[model samples]
Target: MLIGQYFQEKILSSVKCTDKGSAYAKFEWLFGKGLVTSNGQLWKDDRKLLGPSFKLQKLTGFLPYFNKHSKTLVEILTKFQHQATNVYPQLVRATMDFISESAFVQDSTYQINDEDNFLAATHMALTSFRLRLAKPWLAITPKIWDLFGLGKQDKICSQFVNQAMSEAIEKRKIALAQEQKSSSETGENHANQKAFIDVLLDSKSEKEIIGHIMTIFGAAFETTASAMNYTLFLLALNPSAQEKVHFELDSIFGGDKNRDVTLNDLSGMKYLEMCIKEALRVCPPVPVMVRKAQEDIPLDNGQIVPKGCRVVILIREILRDQEHYPDPEVFNPDRFLPDECAARHPFAYIPFAAGQRNCLGMKYALMQMKTCLAHILRRFHVSTSQKRDDISLINGMVMEPKPKLEIVLTPK
Candidate 1:
């Protein structure tokens, strides 16, 4: 599409993007208003202040949260041991609970599927949102289906979610204001749960915090759950790979359930890490990253992608590059062993993305995914349903293998 001779080159990485009205504009759209959405100094400032939260060491405190949520998730899945069912939903609920606890610590209602708490409005708004939502939400993505006229229904959905967030933000502002005043009068050091909401409330504006909480909630719950779901799927596909992970767990922890996995233990999970890397190579959570050419950047091929262009970094294509990855289609975990993997360009396999816009949830998400996998694998022998191949392959803002991810879980 960008004048490359072949499809692979065009999608892989041949040209830098610049069009505003192109698919490559999705990332720019999502982060457009906030630091994540921008490229200049605003992005720099936000990244500088918030980036340290993701550093490996600063995140150790969240391990207990991950472990606890993982145990709860495993308990839920164990209840369905005999039935052939999709595991992704279970994981979604679990990860959502974890992220919700870590973000909107004061709001119990944000956790979906709670019997007494339901966001019928949210579900209603988002369901027909793409097709029926208004122009602003639709326009949020610079590149999308504009062939059809913009619908009022779509706009309403957009308004609804925003309205919901606005209400929550207002309430949080009042609550925080009261807490601050109360603390000042009593001279009592207030307690906070350190969730994203708490993090933002400390230094940022209420409205900005609202925007960030929405973005973080979306990223934290969905991407991590997707990663965990795919990990389970890949392990189900490769039993030997799962066994190797089990072997590592056994060697490292000696089947002792009391010994919780720590950061050091994660480093010891070399093969399991490779398996995760290889799975990501095959099916990244965000398969393609979209970027806009805010300014023209020249490439090695002497092509200058002019400003205002939209670019699609087809990470799938790059990860499967025959030139970079020999036997590109195979799910070979050993391909990621330090000696084998260090030979390639780090940019070639970008599941989490590259440069400053990289995922802030990377460390937290990885911890959640890895710990859940370790716990589940340690406790049960897992296998896919007979109909796994027949599962619907649905593509959304994220790609998912639908329905029949049904796995047979037996007590180990």
Candidate 2:
């Protein structure tokens, strides 16, 4: 296992080091040959082609979708106010809604309303994936496993999700073709406001597009939802920290809690951003990431990582290192203040990993998170009796609080 910022910078920044680890391969069944599971030239080509869709300026176009879904989330949560409610599932569905509109240009209210079974299928597939990872004996060849009916349910769920995404991709391709014909006739251009699927359709085959869409959507929604839930959990445990977030939100929206969050409003949310950053540091969505060493790489400790070694980056340990963060267990958003952040090593706190293969949707995730939190905090006072020690986290695909995250939401 690789610990410390020096290794993080050296290995993650290396040109030859690829994310073709065993853990990543486990995702191939669900994510296919998407960016997350891809390596080498294919990964590079996909990253470059998809890069423009997530640019900071282009992200501004997604704020409306973020705000709309966040409002829906507020309405949904209001029903459970004054009672301890497990909000993680709701947050995940809301984020699914956000990604559906922003990335795929489709309405996912059916999933949110439980009319569609996509979310349940996804959860089943992920649970089975984790189980298979834990018990290697259960990870037999697909044909043998199916013949024995060992992973029948998981296989069905995986097929359901893949089919759903495939259909969505095909539908979008046809719509894009018609839109292009209309635009050509009218001398109009909308290259600047293209959705993520639209961009992929321009340069990818249908099968390839399905893989990219599933990969991007899965990565974006699940991690963002986990991060948001963890932040809310921490804020609920620490009222003062929660109040600081409320104060910052009040300063920005000020008596108009129902107003949509503007780009300027998002930029001005310094303290809220700090709280989110601190939450990420405490309980990152992905606590561990694995990258395979393509070639022998030397470390500052005078040891060389052998070629083809599976190097594990312990992100949770690195973020909580005493050398970098004092009183690391404390929930202090001020730890992320400007001066303190400046003094820390660049790789000391990589919630989204770092270097070339870092998360492409980092900016988009943060914006969606901040906007959602702003909407919720502005209208609701979230509190929970669950203590930090009582919560057990499952460090699987995404770090999830086991037994669900139950919290009370009272009107502000």
Candidate 3:
């Protein structure tokens, strides 16, 4: 197990020393051979091909979808006002809707309808994927497991997700063709604002497109939702911090809660961004990351990692280390204040990991999260009876609150 900044920089920054660990192969069954599961040339090519879609400028185009779905989330939570509600599922659906509209150009009215088989199937599929990773026998005997009906649900869920995403890709292709034809006839140029799916459709095959879509969907929704939930839970337990966030939001919006969050507003949300960063520090969405050493890599501490050895970076522990963060258990947003952050070691706080293979959607996730929180906090006062010590996290692909993250939303 590796902890602290030096190892992070050495291992993650070295191109030849680490690709992805072998464990990520298990993700291929569910996420396909997308950017998350691919390594070497394939990973590089996919990253380059899809890179333009997530640029800061491109992300501004996604704000409308974020605001639209965040409004739907607030509306849905109105029914549970003053009642302690499990907001995780609602958050999951809201983020699912965000990714669907922004990335796939599909209208996923998950929040309004409250019934999404695709979302449920995705949950099941993730659970099954985790199970396979835990049990080596399950990974080896896929045919036998299916023959004995042991993997029926897993198979069904996987098939359903693939088919659904495949169909969405096809639908977008037809729509794009029609749009292009119309633009050609009228001499109108609509090329500046292409969705993520539109960019993929231009270069990738159907199978490859499905892979990338699933990769982004799988990476984006649940993890972003988890991060939002954790931040809210932390805020609920820490009213002062929550009030600070409210104050920032009020100052930014100037008592007008209904207006859309402009790019300038997002940039100006310094305090709220601090709370989000602190929440990420306290409870990162993904608790651990594994990287396999490709060659004999030497560490600063006079230790050598032999070739083909798997190294686990203890993100949760590293974030809480006293070397970097003092009184790390305390919920203090000031830890991320500009001067303090400048004083700290760069790799000491890598919730999104570090290096070339760092999360591609980091910027996109932050934008969506900030927009959602700005909307939620502006309209409601969040509180919870649960204390930080009482919370137990189940560490999986994402670190989730074990029982559920329950909070009471009292409208301001």
Candidate 4:
């Protein structure tokens, strides 16, 4: 087993680039050739330019959007009380709206009932990519996918997303210019809203702005939905854990389901955080991520990963290693306790990955999960007819629970 000598040394931090240039090539069609796809100086420059926007203080500004959208999710879940239903779409839409509000400073209007073609195109494009991933020949040759009509549909979807993003970028640029003029004339800097768009708008070109914004938007939702989905699934299967989460919420908010989740509330949610962490450990949204060795890299055990070799790290497996987590298969949040975590290797649990090229929106994603779950558990009791063994997860960029997730929620 490549366990003891390999991972314990934390060699992943040595990785400088993802295999996004190849593995996520199809994604570049929709997301533009941005940071996620670029490498070396381009990736470094983009990372440098966009880093501050995801800082803790900056992410705090996005809390209101998370809180606002979580309420909508709670309302939707309440409507489906006592019924076994798939809640993933609602979670995706909530995050979609949250991203819209936080990044575009407006609504994308991607409601459950709306015929948003852009959203449909996004779904189709991802499905096409997933299909091609399973059948590598289709992806290996662009003509093969186009011959089967998959590539055309993917392009159309990419165009739709790009067009929408382009329009949004233009509008923001004009509005920002006007705001600057107004401020200059008034001799007062009254910029009321801070958003991801503000950071993207600072980029040198419109294409650069679109690329960065789409990169942020592209990375935001599906991963978050997966995290939320598995988190809810784990909590539902383990009622003892669910009850503890409820108790924590009740104590914090005084049983007020409608209460706003402040940053302070999230900090106080120590146990809920553990539950989320443990859930991610077992069913990491991005189960496997590929990194290419830039140079000859030596492992702690006198082994070397030659340059240009592809390294795939199994995040889910490592998190469940018996050596690190006793009773590895169990859904025990206590395993993530501070003392317990400190005792383990630093790289034992990396849901968002690690090092210089880790997920940029990690802090943002965690806040969204905590805020949304806080609202959800406080307002409703979650249970599912589906057992743990019933979960059939498919490997995409994220681990998607197959068929559908049928959870029953009862309003508290």
lDDT of 4 at 98: 80
Q: lDDT for model 1, please.
A: 0.63
Give one digit per residue, the lDDT tens place, for model 2 in 203-258: 88877877787787778888898889988889999999888888888888886889
Q: What lDDT score goes with residue 272 in model 2?
A: 90
Candidate 1 residue runs with Cα over 4 Å from true position? 1-32, 35-40, 105-113, 116-194, 385-394
Sequence-dependent TM-score of model 4: 0.93
Write one digit per residue (lDDT tens) for candidate 3, span 308-405.
88888888988998988889899899999999999998889889888878888899999999999998988899998888778798778788776787
Supply candidate 1's per-residue lDDT for 300. 61
RMSD of 1: 5.3
| Clash count, candidate 2 | 0
Better candidate number, 1 or 2, judged by lDDT: 2
* Candidate 3 displacement at residue 248 in angstroms: 1.1
lDDT of 1 by residue, 310-365 (tens): 66566666778787778876778988888887897667767887654667777777
- The TM-score of predicted model 1 comes to 0.78
Which ranges of candidate 4 are over 4 A from the true structure? Answer: 1-5, 8-10, 15-21, 181-193
Candidate 4 per-residue lDDT over residues 271-383, each given as its tens digit: 99999988888888887776776777776668777777767777777777888888888999998888988987777777887776788888888888999999999888888
Candidate 4: 10-residue stretch with minimal lDDT? 1-10
Model 2 spans with C-alpha error above 4 angstroms:
147-151, 185-187
Q: After best superposition, candidate 2 residue 392: deviation in angstroms?
A: 2.5
All candidates' TM-scores?
Answer: 0.78, 0.95, 0.95, 0.93
